[model samples]
Target: MSQSDELAAQDAGDSGDGPIEELAELQVKEEARLEKLFAEQREERGLDDETTLHTFFKLFDMWIQLYRLNKCMEVLPEVVPICRSRGGDFHVKGVQALAFTLWKKSQFNDAVKLFHEIEDLIGCSAALCENMGHTYSSMGNFDKASEYFKRALQCLDKEEELGKKTGDRAGILLGLGLIEDRLGRFEQALASVRESQALFRQRANGKPSSLVAKAGMSIAKILLKLALQEPDDDKRQEMEDEAIIREEENVALFEVTCGEDSPLTASALRGLGEAQKRRGRVPEAIASFARSYQIEAQKDAFDLLGIMEVHNHLFGAHMDLVKLGNPLNRASFRNYLPTVDLALDRVRSMKQDANAGAYYKVAGEFAAFAEEYQRASKLLSEAVCLFKTEDDSKVEGLISHCEELKDFCDAQLSAVRGSATANVSESKS
Candidate 1:
């Protein structure tokens, strides 16, 4: 059978197994098949041949479709010599693919450099601006991201005027909204996101597609934030209630569309947890956070920073329970220590000094509250070092505060050890 037919047959014969897992496995198999096919073609035609380059492009696209971005990174360098010699269009396509793959792989700096190269070659298009916007947003450069998103919107508008629809308007609006939200323009963010959500809904024929779910989630989160800023108690409560309902709907929608085990579902759950926590529903919040943690932690390419954030939430929720004098939650501290340790280890491995510093500081605060003074001091010291290395204006104050806290924790640890040693000596005497 042909490859397409074989894939169709496989999909048709899919049993009652996990749909997301099954789909992922299918993609992996397809990627492997393509790789093998490409190898055979390259061996026959050699790298510089037209047929081999065609196969190379096909393989690169396949890798992107399968989210096997690392594979794209591995092969791009090998094909660069041939692709550059072919033509401007060919080289542009290859470079664009590499940049996009790098962004997907979280190598933002390298991705930006390649993106600039693409712009230097062919000038800016809506798609190029959109990709750059996304990459900048990922790097936390909100102002630059906003500029790119606006540029993309302008390009889209020009295209629309020319009667050439690209169907990227909704996504661009959503991206702008996200950047505005980060920049604290909440009202603008809300309006943009709501408009984007409406567009997505219309595109989906009022159905729940992934785009609609994402836009809905963004709207819900903005509403939750607005609720926090509301002056009137009644209006705040109403907004909070609406946000919670929207979150719950999004969670259900994600479970149906992306599977319960999907990262989208986990993110929806985490948002729901945040909403619940805001409403002082500690136990419910804990359950939601725990479920989110479970799903995210199981993924092979899990977002370590996201997982750490979830762990922090879980720790906070558990600590809240203990603060309320819940005996059941007291032992939960012991259960959480290992998770905190694991998260900190992963953060250190990430080599993002600022992010690692923030995580360490948070972990240290939790450890200090748990009376694990020694661990707290160590964590705080690491944070101090990291913060000191950064060039932010606030870093010096943060470093001093962390150092002060670390001193307190060290003193507490020493006192505790001294008390224990004295008790042992008395018993021996």
Candidate 2:
């Protein structure tokens, strides 16, 4: 057989073996040769406690190949001290890798510490600064995130002056736009995203890329926000129409770039559904959300935030579908109630999380749809308490609104009971 065919045959034989099993088998087969190589390398380098990290590095490599992120994290704490003791490219690569691994684990503090190490080592490059910015953004520190992102752009600009490739520079713009959006600097966010979109378009080799699609979604989302804030009816209509157009374009780009069943396409579908919901296309919105939810449900691994958001959207779509006064949809609406219940249970368990306010608000809304008015009131009340405890001034207005909603539900329950009591009294008479 040719080399390719031989490799293919070997792959075919191992295809049925699980990832851990395959790795174990390979390690067992390579033990003797690996031992000899390791001994020679240690002898050459004069092995020490710090040098032991070089051996631990192999575990991280395996974990990366297996998508075993938690395992990578477990190995990282052991690797870091040794790397700090033995300074070289090993230290540099180890610090960067540890920062990224910490970021993956959502341990933003440790990630930022390693980011500082990277900065102290060789100063910040575009990638290093962008990573710091990303970690800050994930921790909900928009101001710090924006600062680093801008610094990243500056670094990339310097690289361009030196005739370097300046690859992925547009990503800095994307990050800046996201942070700006979080800070409610809509106009600036729009400009950055538009610029990033143009750059991605310029770089695309015919096919639409994920970056382009994401930039389009950001534009659409910003437009939607602007439309909601617009005072003039005619101007608001124009903005809404533009948002709808961009949302459609986003779906098209995602379908082309990620195919229909991929997570990217599902997210695009969800965005389109949100736009359709705003346009009062209840049936279309319901269909889009159902499709997105189905696609996401088939995947075993999904971020907590994404899964919660999908469940929220699905609940809202079902509620909207029922609002159309369609009997068929009324029954189907109940089918989605269980999903929201499960999602709410998960969110309740994460009550101490930073996102607790949003999660509680979504779950409360879902409960309202299920006619569990008391449950809705309780969840909204907890959400208010969490927002207060978390010192989130940004969402004070939202907390007030949900509090009012909880009170309204309480009033509704009282009214229903009062009417039922009157009917029973009349029947007794």
Candidate 3:
């Protein structure tokens, strides 16, 4: 037999083992060798001599890959003390990684401590400050987040004057935009996002980068916010139309650069759903949100998926059982009520969190459903209270609606008691 035929016959005899498996085994061996090299370098540098810092870092990275964020956090403290003791360029990098890992694991206090430590060691890099701001923002301390984001911008500006590349500056601008958006500074957010978009477009030589995807997503978010604020019917329609166009473009860019499975793609899909909802395309909006929710769920992005569902309902994709049409339509609507109720229940649970306002707004959405209105009103009133404390003008309408509902409920209770008294008097007569 020829050599190829002989190997094929032997493979067939061995139950069809193939070259792909051999390649995978070779890759694993190569990775092991590379990891060994990293460990040797760490030991020679005397950083965690007994246990390699590189190995710990690699293990933490692997934990993140496996979606074991809590485990990653548990390993981080072990590496951090060694990095702090042995001060070097890699030490700063280690601090940054640890801070980010803590932030991802929702250990905000630890993240802040590490960020402060990094700032002291590195003398304030924009990247460190921006990440600290992100950690604060995730913790719902928007004011503190905005302060750090501004500091990051200042650092980036100084670096730019010293002839640094534009990449860091662009990143700072994007960070500022996100912080501003969260704080409801829509105009400032737009300006920051646009600046970042311009910078990314200038940097793109031909192919798309992750930066481009980020910029597109930021601009889309700004546009969506603007659309929401527009009060004039024609103006709002125009804004929604523009937002839809931007969303489609962003989705295309995200798919091309990061593929459909990435968080950016999921965000773009959610934005598209929002725009479609604004345009009164309920079915299309629901479909887009459903896909976005599926992708986010697969990535364990539960909070983000919940936010998307809230918007889906807020945009008037009927979640209640009430129908304005025939019996079949009523049945179809009824079929969706269970899902709607589940979403509302999840939102209600989230409202018990420190940041209750976000969930309350979502719960308030089901207020039109008579069966759910009382709960919705209570949630809406709580949201209004939070927003009122923040000096948000948008809460006025919600507060008024909540008061009206409360009054209506009181009146109904009084009428029921009066009727009971009348029945008792008639029975005595």
All candidates: TM-score: 0.68, 0.60, 0.58
As a whole number from 0 to 100, the lDDT of residue 307 in candidate 1 is: 76
* Per-candidate RMSD, Å: 7.9, 11.0, 13.6
The deviation in Å at residue 214 for candidate 1 is: 2.8
Model 2 stretches astray by more than 4 angstroms: 1-87, 104-106, 165-167, 231-238, 248-267, 291-309, 334-429
- Answer with 1 or 2, whichever has the higher TM-score: 1
Whole-model lDDT values for every prediction: 0.71, 0.66, 0.58
Best by lDDT: 1
Which pairs of residues collide in candidate 2? none
**Cα lDDT of model 3 by residue, 1-429, tens digit:** 000000101111111122122122333454466456655766576546535665555544433322344555555666667776777855775676666555554567887887788778767766666766666776778788788778877877887889873225666677677777777888898898788768767856554544555566666667778877888888878877877777787777666644565455667787788788778776677667655654554443245344555355533554421242422233333334444455555556554532456456654544424334455556666766766665446566655665676566456556778999999999999
Candidate 2 lDDT tens digits, 50-78: 45455545444444322345656665676
Clashing pairs in 3: none
For candidate 1, lDDT tens digit of each residue in 205-227?
75445566677788878889898
